[model samples]
Target chain A: MHRRLALATAATLCGALALTACGSSGSGSDAAGPAAGPVKLTFWSWTPNMDKVAAIWNAAHPDIQVSVQKQASGDDLVTKTITAAKAGNAPDLLQAEYQALPTLVSNDVLADIAKQTAGTKDRFAAGVWQQVTLGSDAVYAVPEDTAPLALYYRQDLFQQYGLKVPTTWAEFADAARQLKQKDPAKALTTFSANDSGLFAGLAQQAGAKWWTSSGETWKVGIDDAAGKKVADFWGGLVKEGAIDNQPMYTPAWSKALNDGSQIAWVSAVWAPGVFTSSAPDTKGKWAIAPLPQWNAGESVTGSWGGSTTGVTTGAAKAGHADAAAQFATWLNTDPEAVAALVKEAGIYPAATAAQSGGALAAAPEFFANQPDFYTQAAAIAKNTAPAAWGPNVNVAYSTFKDAFGKAAQEKGDFSAALTAMQQATVADLKKNGFKTEG
Target chain B: MSTTLTDRRRTAPAPGTTPGDAVAPPRRTAWIPTLVLLLGAVYCLIPILWVVMASTKSSGELFTTFTFAPGSGLLDNLAELSHYRDGVYWQWMANSALYAGAGALLSAALSGVTGYALAKYRFRGRTAIFNILLAGVLMPPITLAVPQYLLMAQAGLADSYWSVLLPSIVSPYGIYLARIYAAAAIPDEVVEAARVDGAKEFRLFRSVALPMMVPGLVTVFLFQFVAIWNNFLLPYIMLGDDHKFPVTVGLYSLLQQGANAPALYTLVITGALLSVIPLILLFVGLQRFWRIDLLSGAVKS
Candidate 1:
């Protein structure tokens, strides 16, 4: 027994010492290695399609090997990319969301894609290219996917209620009220509190741009009349029995959908297939409609989030930079590759050629064989304005999301929420060294 | 025999329950322990139940339906996940297994030797050495990971399996646990007896002492295995290569993509479910070896 104690005690101390040494070993290596090897291109992307794109690229061009690393989320990609840039060894190419493009562009992290691809403005969808453009001169990245907002409702639920598909915001609200009055357990519309990106989409639909630059001056408009109107509209929905008191991050919303408590959701082009596919039993029962607008001629169309490919300025090897651009173009525009990508990742291609063609018109049979989804999607694209998101968008959106939730769920004062949002927006813009208009 | 002993012990009256028990209780009811167990079981099972339900969902139903409602997409999800990038999920599982299994084995071995030496030997600066090793337990993992990443980059080893595994092999907590266990379980007289029998120090440890410490070492091995398997921040910061990524990182990337796509949320949920299976199985199988009272045992000895 004494012998056993000694051995056990000895092993305990040994393990502790080893763990300590292990801890130190992770901290000691800091020297950068001499650059070498085949034009090694490290591309950071959050797209599922990038995995396939990498496979195809690797198979075709063994000499110019592209290694695709998946990032955690939208904010994660931005955070990781920034860290990599600060560390002095960024990836050769990165796919940042269109909203984050302004920040990357202002920081000079992205190479001028416009410099490489002449007539890029003409080649892609006008609205998409316009979204990426900061001013008359600097184009930071090229948009690869477009997300157009629409209302995704359970058609069976609508039929059961004897409700006509609402075209106006008022009608939609009334229908929602009826649905709630008929069944207090169910909500008319639901938005995720965890996702601030929804607010960005809503703001766009209301003809409010978060930031519009007049030369060097930044006009902060998140507190504008249009933005306030959108907030009030949504706030009213939650205040009434029109919406659920749950955020998108909660398990309650997912539960509500499965249990038939939440009828419809305001979604993007990518939402319908995702929602139905998640609950395959709901297939053939779901249908799509153009999102309800506050007024006729006011676009129901708005972008949620989509990726744009940019060349990294600090890449170790510029050898694959051109090839990377070519590969990106091929992924977006090349007919076969775009369709293959759509099939793989469900990302709607940003290219007009890809959007106009048979692949989209075929209409994924998953949506109750909805034959005109592309037409509906195309209509949204056509109606969507060239909305501007400032460099401080990420900060602004989160601040607005919090304030909106307070007003929507907590039944707090709307005007006070607007004031709070405006105050925070200006503070963040000034903090980030942008010249905010008083 | 041990199984029956454990079973009997589990049914025994609480320390403060019986009339002759050392401690006194409020004596509200005899149902408290069972209630507490049920509460713990519920707390643990809720997430597990969610995973079981979630893994059955398709990409669409994941968001549209309620979270706990079971869907008919389990096989479809598994098939799709298996088909994702030529079954990269399996590759991640394999990489995770290799990292955790090999890394834990190496950690336990190193911890055994170092812990034994620290506990038994009368060396210079013994207290200081032990204190310094103990100090490692206090240092936050991030402080170590950041510098470790820089160092790996310097060695041109960042993004490689060694970058993750080599750093993980030397576990400070593992060593500490082993030391306390070694001091409590192994007797010094046995070492002297082996020496009198004409055995070398290493042989004495290898033959007589190790056999006695088997139970403690198994506990250490399991602890290290679980620690390495659940590690996300270390591997996330260190690895850039997707092929080299563990399951946690893979699922994170999947979830992030789901922000725009929303379809990948199901994949992420399914992946998370799949990742927990091996660890759950291992825990269920090796739970008997858990000696959680090792630290207090040191104090008592």
Candidate 2:
């Protein structure tokens, strides 16, 4: 019965895909001229309180009114937006992650708004700006926020355990082993297999380019030297039982953080928000530091989560692209709007100007002990290594989760899991009819 | 009906053993079967029990305490859920009620008429039409959601309430069940007798066949109501505006606010707990209709 259901579902989905292809081809004729009333643009976002931020824009720009339609975030939203675009019913504006830009672009869902957003490029970091441009002249989106990797540790617990803050990978591993020796009941931290983005970020910090394209052909390097080094290091830790191998974002993980069974988290700038709810009892005891370096003196880090606002092709077809791009630029770069985004939505603004002062000068309430939290985060955000994303990032990420999840459970070889991820990603890319290179 | 009667009589207690069985202590209990059933019940109810217990805990105590231990944060969670975006959770609840209630009614009505025609009429192509519906019954509704969404977009009805409602109104399984029930419960001789008396076909169906099919149609209605109430993918894909979203999609949006914000687990659990109340009430209130025998005294066998 279950097999029959699965087959029927696959057939129906294929039928829908064929229908969407036919439907999209008939509706590309551009609608000319300005509207008789305000140019109403629909914006889809998953950020909390975005409606309030849009309201701030709405009160000022009566000419181009933007309405925010909140959506569930992550890879599913990327698919939803692409499907909506195929049906020619896509919203005018979209909040897409940095990695999703390539997929959206390849699908013809995003519009090139470089002409309108040209002047705002200086407002954001070069690395952050490059993500939206995709190393091309056409700008597909404006950077909204950036989540630079960092290390968060329990301050009092570190003092109690007589451990110093680690500055390099070697010291970090030694600390994990030392803590396990001191108290077998606790761990220095966990190596979570459930989060592929974390591993990808770690790889990026070690200068791995997972995806790179030249002309029309794509190259995938998921099992490159940097990626193998990072995976092997954590795999060794799990094998030795120096760190917990359980996944994060579970109830047990939350308990570990709350009760100090885990004293440190290798996370991003958004860790405080998570700690606020997941480990509310340990709020004031935590402090942030730069991610431990691959080399002893390196200052470079990598990003785990961030988003960009893009104008969709549907807006361009409806002749609302200019207004949409204007709003997108303002939403990211305008000081007032960025501050509202920071205050209302709790996002770490990607625009370099908004990273330090004004809305970010004060620490989050949950991190009240770290008075210069934003200042420290800004320093880490400066050296984020450039990340390469492809049109099939979703496939790569899912494969990473599955392969690494099993490997972590058995304390098995992670290099083998990485090879599996690499093969699956390459196979999917070829199946999608993309030209590929080794 | 006569075969069922004989089977019941054959299964009845033998005449000589009745008095002894009634006066004696109960036969040895089926320990293994009882244990298996108890285990099944526990397996089914533990998740619900977890939800109930987890809904009462504050975020701090939620994962730290014992799995089944109840905390003192239920009221706080309720207030927060109610205050979330000016009670948008209630809006979702109301939307779900509207979709499920109205969609089920319309579906039941359509199924009744279609099933009656299919069972009673001898028109050409009736067999083919029924066969097509059978194929549709085999096809899972989940698979058709994307195609239906594309069609709705073509009609300029995407993101509207009708997009969700219209697709839900044409359940093939409901129509199939209704047809089978009508064929079994309604006697052809009575319809012929009503027709011979010069009664119109519509009146004959309304006055005679419809009343007999009420019990079966009630079953159809309840099935459709629950299906539409719990449906997630259809409404999630159809509706863009959060105001039009059903509770399933609304709770999903709460849980997936992005990587920066933690999921609102307490409020979602509380909302889930509250949402099931209406379903329970509905099941309890409408269960009496299910007891009406489909063919009770409808024909002489």
Q: Which prediction has the highest DockQ against the true structure?
A: 2
The CAPRI category of model 1 is: acceptable
DockQ of each: 0.35, 0.38
True contacts kept of 1: 0.43
Model 2 scores a TM of 0.92
Query: B-chain TM-score, every candidate?
Result: 0.88, 0.88
Query: In terms of lDDT, which candidate is strongest?
Result: 2
Candidate 2 wrong stretches, greater than 4 Å: A1-34, B1-28, B291-301
Task: Summing lDDT over every window of 10 consecutive residues in candidate 2 chain A, give the lowest-scoring window.
Answer: A22-31
DockQ value of candidate 2: 0.38
Docking class of 2: acceptable
